[model samples]
Target chain A: MELFFQFVSNTGFYLADYRNVIMIVVGSLFLYLGTAKHYEPLLLIPIGFGILVGNVPFFKGFGLGIYESNSVLHYLYFGVVTGLYPSIVFLGLGAMTDFSSLLARPVLMLLGAAAQMGIFFTLLGALALGFLPKEAGSIAIIGGADGPTSIFLTAKLAPHLIGPIAIAAYSYMALIPVIQPPIMRLLTTRKERLIRMPELREVSKKERVIFPAVGVLLCCFLAPASIPLLGMFFFGNFLKECGAADRLAQTARTAIIDTATILLGLTVGASTQGDVFLTGKSVCIFLLGAVAFSIATASGVIFAKIMNLVLKEKINPLLGAAGVSAVPGSAREVHLVGQSEDPENYLLMHAMACNSSGVIGSAICAGILWSFMVGL
Target chain B: MYGLQAITAHNGWAMAFAGALIVFSGLVVLSFIISQLHKVLLLFEKKPVDFQNDLERPDIEPPEDKLGLSLPKQFPADIREIARLYKPLVEALGETFCLSELYEILRKNDFPHPHITLTALRESEILIPDGDGVFTWNPPTENDDNEKVEG
Candidate 1:
């Protein structure tokens, strides 16, 4: 009886606290949202399960938690800590991306730039709210809406806040469909939504091949800190566009990205232990993330509306909503909202052009923030 | 350490405004560069400008190079079979999908030569473009219908 009681004392049931239960419930909600609502299941599922794994309550100093140096999860999380996984994920994104749309319509790239206003806006917000400059920068990237970029910047700027920042970034990215539509509707009229964009001209084989090379040079020269992330991103794109390395591109888009995403999601989720994640600061980060994401969406739409005043041929303002780095998610939402207003308005390609530029724009913003923090 | 004072003390106002400016500038420069890239490529692709020769032969026109006319001149002969294969698939996307969506569907289905088939469809006027990215598949021609009836 004594031995059995001792074993019971060592069990999670005995050690578990209210914070663990709260985090576990949050984890379950993420799982339900992913599986049932089908919101980024590839990401949310691993993260949801990882949250459950992390919150399972263990006694201290047993090398059990993700934060513990000697643990297996800590070893797996090294890729995240060193910013390797996000960079690898960017490589895969580059392989899969088709820049022809952006190439065909470069002015739409400005919508992407407009969207990045949210990142800086959020940085100011965080600073006013009493977050240290580094933490403010890390939290601000959640507005960029690119999960990998958020993780990369947070890992560098404020490694301690990775759990909340990563979770906030991915959560908002998944919730894009839910969050963006109302704001889009509030910001634009039916006429704006029904505005059909001009067609993208055919990008030539040579131009298609040259973009990645040019992208790396122009972006890296301007923001040298972005070299690590944008360097791998452009290299993967060059492999795909160069035509000489199709097999490598094939493996990169599939195997390399998939493996990296799995590790990143699981480790980021597991890093959110109850005591660490249930802080007042974590709640502030989530609130700031929401504000930042909304601002980005609004800025993109407003900029398009503003541009319409200057230009003869009008762009659908909804394309601006796709300016954040949520990729196909926000872009798809823009298309859906556009289609709802006018069935004939097919905005996917145009939205895709804006969407791709958002990736570059956000990365540049991340680079800028990182360098600013370092210099300051 | 909160509010406007905190922002100023930490140089928050300076960094935020500067950071935003840098981001906008970087993307603007990139967008400008990319906007001009195809034009530059067009220039290089032109027959060596030949400055002295151009001065002598001013009346000679440059090539008819333009965007949106990159479609191949050769239309593939097997339009009927290709049409048969894709008409149903295009219908699955209903009335208004863009060319990229069609390409994605074809690519997903492991259909052979997706890129070539798309270009051919455009060339042969089977997939009519709206001058925007939106496309519409023409209703079956009488020949295709007759061939289908016979088969």
Candidate 2:
């Protein structure tokens, strides 16, 4: 009887500590948000569960291969911490992206640049609260609305702040449907939102091929620290969509990317240990992230309005909202809003161009921060 | 313990402060590069002799027989256009069923075992194999089709 009691006590099945319970509840929230609401479930579900597992008081030894030095996830996360995976993901994105919309109207890229203001502003806010500079920068990048970039940057600059930043980045990205619409409505008049853009001239295949190569060369030469991540991103994209490399494209988009995502998600989740994650600083980072994201959306829209004064042909200001790192999500939101104003309005392709530009812009922002950190 | 805590805290703060300055400098360089690239791209666009003229080509029409092109297979017009567009691939596959046949199968069933269909036809020993990498449709039992249909 005493032996049975001892076995039960030793077993980790029982919930024991308050912190464990809280973290488990937090994990369940992530799962529920992912499964029920379908909010960035791919990464959040794993991250949530990692939080639960890491917080299990009696299960300190249960590494689940995530923390194992030789594990696949650990190795993949080496790319994350070193700022490689997100950039490679960006490369795949670059390949998939069509920048013709922004090319047709070069002004939208400026909207993307303006959207990054949320990052700087949020960084200042985080710093004002006495968070370390690296942590503040990492937290601020959540405003960029790019998940992998957020994860990659946070892992490098502020490993301890990973949970809040990851959670904040994805949550805000998911809330694009919720948060951006209201701000977009408040900032732009119905007339501005409904403004019809001129038909975009079709971009040639040759130009498409040159865009990534040129973009990669330009950004890398300007900010060398951004090279590893941005270079791989553009390369992956260039390989995938370059018309001749169907096999390479198939591998990058499907097999390699899929495998990386699974490992990256799990390991990123594992890094969200409760002792490190459950802090006042983490909560503050979340609040600041929200501010950063909102500011980015507003800034993009405002910048577009400013450009409307300069350009002869009218530009739809709503598409400017897609300047955040949420990529298609923010882009789709802008497109939908435009369609609502005029059903014939097809802003999807145009919005996609700016959205992709936002991805590059955000990476450039991170690279800049990284250079500063390295004192280069 | 207090001294150690203070040192760690101080180190963390200093690192973060340094990080911000680097980020700002990096942003300045990036902005400059992007602006210059923008000017170059604009210059390239304005140069009419360059392939920039191709952007305004109105004579371009959708292909009449789109066979090999990776166009979106959304509509019957697109498929017809694909058929017209892919005339070269169709002519190249002369003796065998062409992309038109594949399109027919795909349109009907929404899927087809392309390799199986090709291999089965090849096994009947009537059609000549090109030996090149491109698979052409060559049905062996073409002569027997009338009798088989009549029966």
> Number of the top candidate by TM-score?
1
Worst 10-residue stretch by lDDT in candidate 2 chain A? A57-66
lDDT of 1 at A214: 89
Candidate 1 chain B: worst-modelled 10 consecutive residues by lDDT: B65-74
- Candidate 2 positional error at A296, Å: 0.8
What's the residue-level lDDT of B134 in candidate 2? 37
Poorly placed runs, candidate 2 (over 4 Å): A52-57, A61-79, B1-151
Candidate 2 positional error at A284, Å: 0.7
Model 1 over residues B6-99: C-alpha lDDT tens digits?
A: 8999898888889888888888888898889889998886766576576677586775422222223442346666787687788888887799
For candidate 1, list the clashing residue pairs, or say none.
Answer: A199-B132
C-alpha RMSD in Å of predicted model 2 compared with the true structure:
11.6
Best by lDDT: 1
Candidate 2 DockQ category?
A: incorrect
Give the TM-score of candidate 1 (chain A).
0.99
The models' CA-based lDDT, in order, is 0.89, 0.68
- lDDT by residue (B22-134, candidate 2, tens digit) is 43344444445444555576687777845655776558775545333454454222222333433444455465554446445433333223333334334543223556543
